[model samples]
Target: MSNLNLSFACWDYDRIQALTNGTVQAKGIDLNWLNMPVEETFWRMMRHQEFDISELSLSSYLIAKDRGYPNFTAIPVFMSRFFRHSGIYINKHSGIEEAVDLKGKRVGIPEYQLTACLWIRGILHHDYGVHPSEMNWYTGGQEAPGRVEKIKLTLPPDINIQPINDEQTLNQMLESGDIDALIAPRAPSCFLNGSPHVQRLFPDYVSVEKDYYERTGIFPIMHVVAIKDEILEEHPWVATNLYQAFVEAKQKVYDGFNQTAALKVTLPWFVSEWENTRQLMGEDFWPYGLEKNRKTLEAAVTYSYNQGMIKNRLNMEDLFAQSTLEAYTL
Candidate 1:
């Protein structure tokens, strides 16, 4: 039988380097790997089904699945995981000294349904006394003009979300103090450019993130690997094949962390950092399968549902291919 040829679109992260460099091969398949910006890749795949497999935003994927878009099915491969507390930026003059101070203020977001924003909101509401209904939300592009939410949202009646004018970006509003705060995956240009007025809501974000993770056991999933529904239906074996390849590809990156003879990484404390991270997050810090990530996945599903991104509370099992749910141990 001829190997199935497929196009796979994703960011060229170090962990997935093996897949892009052709060192890791998907079993019984020939992959055309395309390295591109995540937004372009997601837009092309969601709007036109441009690739047979692609990395998709977790929140957008849930919204798409709930709305019956019928384009893709996700796998347990979480390509991006992040702690979003540090993503919340506040105006120093807004009088918001803490997360609780965010109440009754106007906040800006790139989109209401962005996975990073969802996690931020969830943390704010759950950990602190602040609720989504307590503040007004403004949505638009962060640094660029005219970005829109890819999926429609059905926010709670008490919640308020307004879109900014096409002429203005969230960065301008944040810097000018038009918005009290902003929650976005990428820092707005004002903060990145060293504006004294722009600062993280949680100045001690590292400690806060560590405390939150220790309490909740969630590393917050940002993106998942999705396969075209049509391709998946016709070629069921492709799911497991791709999953295994991704696992091996990520393993190659993990193995490089311990290479200390000549310093595998440029950082002087690369090995020390790795050891400290392992101590804090465990040996398999960035696990990819269903079993290891069930708690985090469940929290994300709950957050998505609570935030009105999904019509139904979905079980994590229903989101991924059944064949890839469990590993075949040796």
Candidate 2:
């Protein structure tokens, strides 16, 4: 029989470049890679289930699963992970000199349920004693107006979330001192443009993030690979196959980084940076698989539950395909 054909939508990342470029292929399947911006992929997938497999927001996926609305299941292939400390932008005039100062402040977010914002909120609450209920929240597009949450939310009474006016964007609000700070995966335009009004909450976020990882071992996960439930029901083996393929593709990236004849990446100090990262985080720094990421995953679930994003605190095993929970040893 011919191999199964499926559409997989995700952003083009170096780790998965092999699969996108046909250097790696999933066994028993022919993937039709759809290279799309993460925001578009997430919106379309969450709203319409438009692809066979897609990169999904971890926070939004949990919300959907909790609501029992989407027929989707995930594998352990985390497509995007980041340290969210750098994403927290603040107005210089907002009097928010530290994370603790965020209490009682007005904070803007691209969306209430964004994975990046979820991690930021969780870290702030857990580490800095700043609860979500302590501050007011405004949600809208970071650079454009009219952006809204992909899935509707009915948060608890304590969480104060509101939408900005259709005519206003979070970037403008932050620059004009209309909002105190912004938490998002992407930097606001004003901060990028070096507007005197905007700055990162943690100016030395690199050091802060490293310290966080050393202490907590939680390198926040932002996106996961999700497959349609219908496909899983039809081809149960697809999960393991896809998971293995993603692992192989990621290994290719690791192998490329080991080459020192000439820098595989464009960074002038790529070798030193790679060595420093390996020394800090170990050989497989950007790790895949459920077992390798359990602590981080558990933290995310706990955050989701405490923040009222999910009705129940889901068990870590329930979040991934059962087949993906283990791998065969050679």
Candidate 3:
């Protein structure tokens, strides 16, 4: 088997450390991964289709599907149970204790894309009964001008957004009570949990989130992996080999913390949200089980579709090769 290049997302060190391992080296699989920003990764993929396989965001996947990209399917890997995608951060001194407290308050965010802001607002309005736009919303951040002619053609026009220039200034603004809430994705972010200015607004993570989404058709995206259909048709062995390698690597990292020596290697990689990694999965979470992954993926697709980000419903079959999980050891 030839070396496979995996284009992946910016997961703050924890997930990165888990997936890059000896199993991948032993398999002769080279993960030539490009570390790009969360949103740009998809834009780059759409433009060049450079990587052999990679993780994709749903917005990117929808754009790809609409553009007639072939043979791409999402194999469910991780189930992000928390409000993992879009976080609501309030000033630590603001006395904001819950998600509902942000009502009629000003908020600052980096970008206003289809997936991130849209779903956040949909949940706020449909589920929580708070209108996000009515809140004094600020969308700031400089976008790298689109260079690819074709990709630019496919994307919607920019929405007058200018991302805040400096993290310090944003921090100061939050400290000064200029922005009531800070909304953005994690990693390279001033987010709720990690940001000193903000505290976790909600106590019950999973229950509150599930309740919100069940009432409103909005759910946060964890992450997704996709392979080009052309590559699968041309090289069938790639699926089994790569999937097994990832499965092994994922388990190896998970199992490492249980051992004293391996804990030395893995302790630094544990992010706050990922401290529950071992607890996140039950005793039977390893071996790439299809049942749990399938349930998570189907739920995600249903929510994204219902919210109109997916344009139409996508099934497990449309998005993945179901039998491929069988190829991967549980």
Candidate 4:
């Protein structure tokens, strides 16, 4: 078979790199990983007509879809979940011990409009009965500007999440007991546990989710996968192969492959780092089955619509080109 030239945006996002490993490589589809920062990656993908298969975040997906990159599809490779949101942390000495305790105090978040952060708000208001709008919020998310807007979502009408960004200021405020609690997606700095701090709040789901996750190695939700349109038209089989590779590799990780076996295919990814990253991630972190990712894509579109992130409403059938996945299923 002839080699396929595919455009994949950077490898900094851990899971994207993992997915691109043996899966895409084995199909004679070499990766053109965009080696820039996240913002630059988006712009590069936007300007370059050459992107055959790009790895993008859900927000980035919306942006690309708006700009008319007809081939963009959320592939059915569900490899992440709500773990990357605003984590809720309080000072060790601060008397505020629960999610509800931060009523009229300041909260620090990495960024605004992040999906995981949205999940955090939903959990806080819907699950824990905390009104997000009433509390003061300070954001310290990525310096890359558009990301914050994407992260600052409006929930339940009255709940308007305000944002403030400045890493040093947020850190100083949180440490000085100025911010009563910190609500943000997981950051290396705020991790009391390897996962998000709020996992402590969801007693019922955490254990059940953990047990089932350990049993099946399932990730509950995430941005799913898709092939670039031109590649789907020109080399449909390779796209299907890419999808199959992820499914197979996921099984391989769950089934227990020693260093030599995985490394031969995985190349530079150390088994320890690879294994640890998987263990540190929550069970819902990889929750996409072949058909399930389509559901995630559906949920994502619904969310983008509700959030007013996009002007055009994209149906699943319209957004995803299923020729490759359909053919593979047969």
Q: Give each prediction's root-mean-square deviation over alpha carbons.
A: 1.3, 1.1, 6.2, 6.6
lDDT by residue (1-330, candidate 2, tens digit) is: 899999999998998898888899999999998998999999999999999999999999988878777889999888999999999999999999999999999999989999998999999998899999999999988888999989888888998889999999999999999999999999887888889989999999999999999999888899999999999999999999999999999999999999999999988999999999999999988888888898999898899889888999888788888888866222
What local lDDT score does residue 212 receive in model 3, on the 0 to 100 scale? 58
Candidate 3 per-residue C-alpha lDDT over 64-159 given as tens digits, one digit per residue, 9 for 90 to 100: 664567347555454222354235657777766666677667676554443454456555655566655356655554122222222322212222
lDDT of 4 by residue, 1-330 (tens): 666667665535444444555442446666666555544444455445445655445555664665575446656665446542234556655567666776766776655444555445544664457766767767654222223443223345544455554335454555566666665544434344343322223335446445543553433353444466666666656656776666666655544434455453455767665466567664333544445455445555555554455566776555545654465454
TM-score of each: 0.97, 0.98, 0.65, 0.63
Query: What lDDT does the true structure give each of the candidates?
Result: 0.89, 0.91, 0.53, 0.53
Measured by TM-score, the strongest candidate is 2
Task: Please give the lDDT score at residue 100 for candidate 3.
Answer: 67
- What are the runs in model 4 whose C-alpha is more than 4 Å off? 10-28, 33-52, 59-71, 82-86, 92-95, 142-168, 188-220, 226-238, 257-287, 293-319, 328-330
Give me the displacement of residue 264 in model 2, in angstroms.
1.1
TM for candidate 1 is 0.97
Candidate 3: C-alpha lDDT:
0.53
Question: Would you list the clashing residue pairs of candidate 3?
Answer: 73-319, 140-162, 140-163, 140-164, 141-162, 141-163, 141-164, 287-330
- TM-score of candidate 2 to 2 decimals: 0.98
User: 293 in model 2: Cα distance from truth in Å?
Assistant: 0.8
Report clashes for each candidate as comma-separated counts.
0, 0, 8, 24
Residue 177 lDDT, candidate 1, scale 0-100? 98
